[model samples]
Each structure stands twice: as C-alpha cells, then as structure tokens.
Target: MKSVGVIIGSIRDNRVGDKVAHWFFEKSGVKKNLNAEILDLKKFNLPFFNEDVAPMALKGNYSTEEGRHWYNTVKKFDSFVFVTPEYNAGMPASLKNAIDYVYPDWNSKPAVIVSYGFHGGVNSALSLERIITDKSPIKMNLTNTKPKLFLSKDILNEKGQFKNIDQDFEKYTDEIKKSIEELEELLNTATANK
Candidate 1:
C-alpha cells in the first residue's frame, strides 16, 4: 500500500486544519490502495530556515535535528494532501517553513491541497500553488478551489469544536470527491515515469 501523508498545515491554536486533516484521513483511509496518516507539523517545532544553502541543494541532509527529522517523516510518504487555512490571504508561516525545510523528498510527487477559510482560502491555495510549482519535489495533482470545505460561520461552536464540517455539502462534496479520483490517475502516471 502507498503511504499518503495528510498534512495539517496550520499551527495556530484552535486551527481547524488539524481537524480537517483528521476528517479527511478518516475518509481517505477507507480507500483500499491508500494508507493515510496525519502528519501534523505542530508536533515538530521546526525553526525558520537558517541553513547555509537551500534545502534543494543540501542533497536531503538537513542541517538541524528538527529539520532532519521533518525531512525523514516527509520522505516516507508517496504523496501528500495539505489541509491548510488562509492567514492574511496567505498560508501560515510555519507551513511555509515546513515546506522550505526539504527539497528532494517531494520531487515529482503529487500534492493535493485542501484549504478552508472565508471564500475557501482560495488565495492561500494560489499562494501555495505558486510555491509548489517553483519547486521540483512535489507537483499539484489538483488545483481547483471548491470551498465546500470553507470554514462556515457555524462550522465550529463556542467550545471550538467542529459542528457543521462533519456533514456533507451536497454538490460541493461531489466535486471534492471527483478531484480525489483524479489523483489515482496522477499516481499511476507518476509511478510509470519513475
């Protein structure tokens, strides 16, 4: 089975990215070919990039202890699904730092970014798309922004737990499902090329 990393891309307290990642993984885990695991960056305490060279040029030998461990964990996956939220119309700094910490680990691999926020975090997804495109490790398998996963007004309650997110979003859910199906084809093509 191929390991699929479900990345929770936000580190803000009460950030719903982790919840969405868990929900997505629970759903994705039912797939017979995918072994989904949540790769939470919050647990890693990685520092901002301070190495002498870019991660791509490091040849995968990360400089810091946290960086090395982060690289290794990311390397274990065949593909990734980034669950992120927009902050100031961009992705969180920590998520960007996490991506900057590695190079070779994501080469030619597929990344499906699932973002949520007012208007579905489309801006953040666009920002992320540009970042990923400029890099060589991972490729965007699907880039469409369907805000079905958008952080709805009542999505979370007073206690900061999910309420509306667990239910289906009708047509939007179908669209999201279709996008995931496209990943199977992407994986096949990637495997063949490799």
Candidate 2:
C-alpha cells in the first residue's frame, strides 16, 4: 500500500478546492492499495519561494522552516491527487507557488489532477498537466470525466456544493482506480531498481 495525498491547492475564502480534496480523500481511501490523506496548502502557509537557490538545485533541502515542513509532508506520499480550481484559464497562483517551492519531492511521482469549474476546468487542468509533467517532472495521470457543473443558476445557488454529493462519478472513479494501479507499478519499478 502507498500513502497518497490529495492536495487542496486553493487558499481563497470559501474556496471549492478544499471541498473537492476532502471528497477525493474519502474516495481514495476505499482503495486497498492506498492510504489517502488530505494536504491543504492553506495549512502550510508557505511564503513565496524566498530561497536564494531553487529547490531543484538544492537536492530538495530548504532554507526556511515552512519550506522544510512542506517538503517533508510531500515526501511521505507515493502518489497524489491535486484538487484545483481554474483561475483565469490557469491554476491558482498559490498552487503554482507551492509547486515552485518544491523539487525532487515530486520527481517520478504520479499525480492525478482533478479540476472543477464552469467549463469543467479542463484548461486549468491542461495547464497543470504541463506543469506537473513537464516543469515539475511528476507523472500527470488524468481523468477523462473533467467534472463540470454546467448550470450557472444551479451552481451559484449551491456555491460549488455539487462536489460534496456523491454522483455516479463512475468514469472518474474508474480513472482514479487506474491511476493508483499504475502508480503502484511505478513505485514497484523504482523499488526494484534499488
């Protein structure tokens, strides 16, 4: 079994990311292969990358206590599920900052991105896919479902509460299961090399 962290990547007031992450945390835990936990970035309260040297060059060491805590927390996870919101067609700056603050902690780890928004957050998820897969070097496993809430009146009244309820979610659930299975394989491969 692996320790999986579902990261709540937004820090704004009444944000939907936390709600989404909590939901994912529960869903992931039922999987026998994973020990899922919620990692809220808001709790970390990391300042902008105040380091003189990038974490990538430092071999994942850090100069600040906040940075050290963040790195240590992330290091425990064999896989991740990032619950993010689309901000201006991209992920929140806070999320991007968190990613910038770390390095090898994410290396070779598989990340399943779950983004929700008016347009299903596909654009933000796509942008995030680039960051995790290209820039951060985390494996970007994704769900085809995209998780969109389509009605303006219905959503504004509910205030993103739709995620709190369990829907069919069959497709997304299947994708998540697949991601965990593949991630375990990757983890085994890494261990085998050692």
Candidate 3:
C-alpha cells in the first residue's frame, strides 16, 4: 500500500475545503491499496516566506519551528492531493505558502488537484499545476474534482458544521479513485525508470 497526503488548501474560518478533503479521504480510504491522510494547512500556521533563499532547489534554510514542522509533515507522504478553493482565479494563499515552504519532498511525487469555487476553481487548479511543475517532478493527475454546484449549502449546515450531499459526494469519490489509480501507474513508471 502507498501513503498519500491529502492537502487541504483553504484556511478560512468557514471554508469548504475541509469538507471536500474529508470526503476525498473517506472514499479513498476504502481502497485497500491506498493509505490516505489529510494534511490541513491550518495546523501548521506557517509564516510568510521568511527564508532568504528560495525553495526551488531545496537550498533554503528552514530555521523556524513552523518551517521544520511543515517539512516533516510533507516528508511522510509519497504523493499529494491538493484540495484547494479558488481565490481570485488562483489557489488560496495558505496553500501557496505551504508549498513554498518545502521543495525536495515534493519531487518525484504525484499530485492531483481537487478544487471548488465558482467555475469549479479551474483557474486555481491550473495556477497550482503551473507552480508545482516549475519546482518539482510532480506528475499532475488530470482527473480532478470541481463541484460545479454551489458548495455553501451542502458543505455547511445552519449550525456551521460540515455536511455532504450524496450526489456530489459520489462524484468526488469517483474522481479521487480514478486519480489514485493514475498516480499509482505514474509512480510505478517513474520507479522503473529510476
């Protein structure tokens, strides 16, 4: 079995990213071949890029406690699924911050984008793919999850806790399963070549 890090990209107080992430993991977890876990950005609370050097080549110094914690968290996983919310045609700042904090851990890893927002966060997914491609050897999976429907009502109940609609949940689950299968194939190919 392989372990995948499901990164929840949104850090807003009432964000829908968590709901999406949870649904993705719950479905993926049922597959005996996959060991999935959600990596929430809110827990790290990483500060803005304080390192003088860039993370592109993994040359930067991560001296802060938060930076080290973030790095360690990323190192544990073989692949990633970024659950992001579109913000002004791109991923949220918290997701970018988390990615910027580390480098080599993402190399040779496969990543799938699961985004939700108006227009299904397609712009955000594209933007995120661009960023990841430039720095790491990430095999970006095309089978993504973007709820074309409004998430406000389904993801949040009147009391503010998260909720799920069966239909939308099924779509997300199917996409994640497909992405995972693709990722496994990619990882195997990369390994064989190495």
Clashes of 3: 0
Question: What does candidate 1's lDDT look like per residue over 23-115, in tens digits?
Answer: 766554325477767788898888898899988788767778998889888888877788888989998998899998887777667767777
TM-score of each: 0.86, 0.81, 0.82
The predicted structure with the larger lDDT, 1 or 3, is 1
lDDT, residue 45, candidate 2: 91
Q: In candidate 1, where is summed lDDT lowest over 10 consecutive residues?
A: 139-148
- Which 10 consecutive positions of candidate 2 have the poorest summed lDDT? 143-152
Clashes of each: 2, 0, 0
Candidate 2: which stretches are off by over 4 Å? Answer: 28-31, 134-152, 155-160, 167-172, 192-194
The alpha-carbon lDDT assigned to residue 54 of candidate 2 equals 78
Write one digit per residue (lDDT tens) for candidate 3, span 1-194. Answer: 67778888988878767777777676754245767677889887888878767776544457788898888888887778888888898888999889878877777677777777756788888788888763435434333432332355555679755555555567566556767777677656666788
Candidate 2 residue-wise lDDT at 100? 84
TM-score of 1: 0.86
lDDT leaderboard ranking: 1, 3, 2
